[model samples]
Target: MNKEALIALGLTLEQADKVIEGYGTTIPKSRFDEVNTSKKQLETDLASRDKQLEELKKVDAAGLQTKITELQQENAEAKTNYENDLKASQLSSAIKLALVGKVHDSDIATSLIDTALIELDTEGKVTKGLDEQLKTLQESKPFLFVPEKKEQKFKGWDPAGSNLDKDLPQDIGFNFAKEANSKGAPAEKALNPWGQ
Candidate 1:
């Protein structure tokens, strides 16, 4: 029976006992304390996890900064090495041109000669010296260092026209045709049996 019902009915111990005995049921105790304890433990665990995450973030940031410094050092060294190699190659080309009588200005060639002399020294500043030599060359012979032009080859199918068969050595044309045929190429129109 409910507490209000018991109060309203002015139930005696004997009457309550009779009702409960008939129902064969018992009242359960509250679990408020167990629930409160579990809540507190969960909050504590969350706070500890947040603190650990912050420490990990700091460690990661430090590692990233170290990596950046290392990469910057490597890049600087690589640039220095590349500049030195480029100066050496330019000096070599200049010397080759001078020896081949391709130089126009004696003074500019002399500057290259001096730079080459400096490069041969034990503590030579080849990079700086080469720059000075190039500047001198540019001022003295503005157009003498023009790039060499390449000759274009003839690409027509019949370089000698109707006399192509006769002009080309028999062995050369036959070998070329054989190679082309082996690679599944069609025979030249003039050489084909159908004359296509």
Candidate 2:
């Protein structure tokens, strides 16, 4: 199980190494890789911003001031874009987690969800209309969800609940000591494998 193969499957270096160490066990697609890639891109953007700042320092005072304003605006736009992307990613992940075990077709179910109305709480839980929307969808489009399983109630005797003293006849069970004494054998011989 090569790390490269695992990495190609959208795993990080650490994740790929762990998989290799674990003998190449199957792993589902990871959101961590997406987040990690985004983080690296953000770092690269910051590095470029730093380089631009250094270049701006070498320019005339008027040009440097204009450049500073432009860079600030660009930074603001980048921040907004990053925030929006992060929120969208969070919303998608939250929806997927919520839909698990409930939906038959996750892609269809997720598409049915009105993502615009969904928001995440501070604790990362889906809040402010997601649950209500899911409930509404579950009612209107029942086919998208897995069928609710009905539990069968057993009418037979439950061994775990039954008491042997009450259920079994007193004479039906054997007593080794009584049987051996009746046969004229000693109690010691009946009870112990090695008689003293």
Candidate 3:
């Protein structure tokens, strides 16, 4: 309170000042042994906690770390094997599509396909040179060569020639007719691959 408020409450400013200064006092423990017992208990609890932490720090962690490393290595190995198997399956698919199984020996096809370099950077992509490799194999073993179809050349329209004097293809009511003996028949499949 201010000096005027203290005077209105019938107390001198000096007396009020003393009351405010004596807000709290020290504890008066009548028994000395009781205080000594509490202090000892607190000290013992602190010492036990410290000892527990020290014992925990003394454990052997190196063995556990070694086991973890071994497990990681094993996981990596299994992943590599799985990836290799998947690649083999993909190579086998390409070989089947190329008909190596039907025309050439499976042993040679398997060897070539196995060595084929598949996608190195991306997963699930076929080899870069797989088509060319199969082509090479086809050349070596001509039995599997599929000859490209040759386009037939049609004679242009002429008054005195094969076609009449008129436009073709785009002409309305235009009908094309094939001539006999224009193309030869395909050769029969040879039983022996080396003969062809």
Candidate 4:
């Protein structure tokens, strides 16, 4: 309280001054010190923010916008290039899968196919002339493709125990002369292979 306000409460001039001097001493000094410290910190932060704002005002707005636009364009171009590369990679994988077990040389077959005519769908499938181009390449260059294997047939004689007993007579005699003749030998030579 001020000295005049304390005097208005019926204290004398000396008593009012003493009361004013002892008024705030009852409360801790550290509390006011803390509040003053916080106030100073707030002022310092406000001044720092004001200085930063002044620095920001000095920046070139038009130049910053142009740079931002250029960066955005570069980012868009990079994204487009990445998408194109991804589509091309997917198309190459599709082509390789389609050529598996069909082409003699996969690299040569891939080179022969018209990749420009091919397009990848959203599902990453060949959506255009890839199949037709591969077919045309196969027809134009037959040597590049592995020939379709012909189904093989077994033509050799059957096993001895299989159906032979039913076909032949039970008393079919063993004729040495016929056997030897069939083997391109005389009967005597066939019987004595040692030439004894």
Candidate 5:
């Protein structure tokens, strides 16, 4: 009999082997205990990490929403400012254009009225006190006069058949088909699909 059998029979291996003849059932249980403990610890860690991830996602979503709202408000304000500036610039240009030949002192009030009309036509009546005062002066102006024409200086002209023409070869008409076939035969079949 084996020593394990002897121990199972409540005797020392030597003593039980002398009295019995079978082996003992002696499988170790410690490995299973350790595995169970490790598994429980891993499960707990995974649950904690999952919870933290969910919370972080919530915070990110809230931050993105706030950013979106802020950007939209900024966009609206920029559009409003752009429109206001555009109107002011157009009104100023129109007034300057309408004041071209008018006298400074005679009918200053009438000139001012014409200036206001030009501004109204161009910028749709969004006016300030300064704009009103300018319009008043423009309307009060008296004599209407023609603006003088401006003189321009002429640059030298190009000569016929220069090397500059060589740089622009396409401007020189080269009839390759006429050279090939003489009497203006219908343009030879295009050399390539795009007729290069």
Candidate 6:
């Protein structure tokens, strides 16, 4: 059934496989074996070259650690900048909202806010120039000036008369037990009925 067995019987092997199956007939045995061995050698050589290339491209531990540290530092700086920018944006937006109907356009509002924030401190407190700009804006556009909100002061809870003591029995009394401390002071203790 195979070509090699037929060749051993002193008969030449004829075409037995179809060309559509990607196999060629009438190939010499020696040639096929040589091609197969050469193909395997080429594959092995390619794998070896690929491994060497990978070794060349691979980073050392020190280089990789340096890159990681650099990326971490960059990320930290970016985070800090983003936080600062976000805070500035919020401040600018608050000012713009205060100047809603006064400015002719948004650009004017932005410019006014920027001018007011020129001397803003690191804590975002407007320490200088903000009040003057606000006053100027207020005088020019009185409707846009919003008065500062007055802080509401709250009084804490007070135990007031609820007629609680008025309706209680007049003969009622608190009988607390007392103990002698190391300092010889009469220290009050709870009136424990179980003698605990």
**Best lDDT goes to which candidate?**
2
Task: List candidate 4 segments past 4 Å from native.
Answer: 1-26, 160-196
lDDT of 5 by residue, 159-195 (tens): 5434355564332224444245455445564332222
lDDT against the true structure, each candidate: 0.61, 0.78, 0.60, 0.77, 0.57, 0.61
lDDT tens per residue, model 6, 90-180: 6676555545655556555467554534555676544566566767766876654445568998676634433346654222122122221
lDDT of 5: 0.57
Q: Give all TM-scores, in the order shown.
A: 0.26, 0.49, 0.35, 0.64, 0.30, 0.35
Assess candidate 3 and give its lDDT: 0.60
Error of 1 at 122 (Å): 24
Model 5 TM: 0.30
Ranking of all candidate structures by their TM-score, best first: 4, 2, 6, 3, 5, 1
Candidate 2 per-residue C-alpha lDDT over 149-188 given as tens digits, one digit per residue, 9 for 90 to 100: 9998888665542445566533312344445555656655
Cα RMSD to the true fold for all candidates: 16.6, 30.1, 17.8, 13.3, 17.6, 17.1
Identify the superior model by TM-score, candidate 4 or candidate 5: 4
Point out the higher-scoring one by lDDT: 1 or 3.
Answer: 1
Q: How accurate locally is residue 175 in candidate 1, as Cα lDDT from 0 to 100? A: 54
**Candidate 3, backbone clash total:** 0
Clashing residue pairs, backbone N/CA/C < 3 A, model 6: none
Regions more than 4 Å wrong, model 3: 1-60, 100-108, 118-127, 144-196
lDDT of 1 by residue, 1-196 (tens): 4544654688886777677678744443446677778999999999999999998877877778999999999999999999989887666554554435444554455544565444533333233355466566667765755445689898878643345566544454555675666565554433432222
For model 4, residues 57-163, the per-residue Cα lDDT tens digits are 99999999999999999999999999989877888888887778988888788877778888777776777787787777777888888889999988878664354
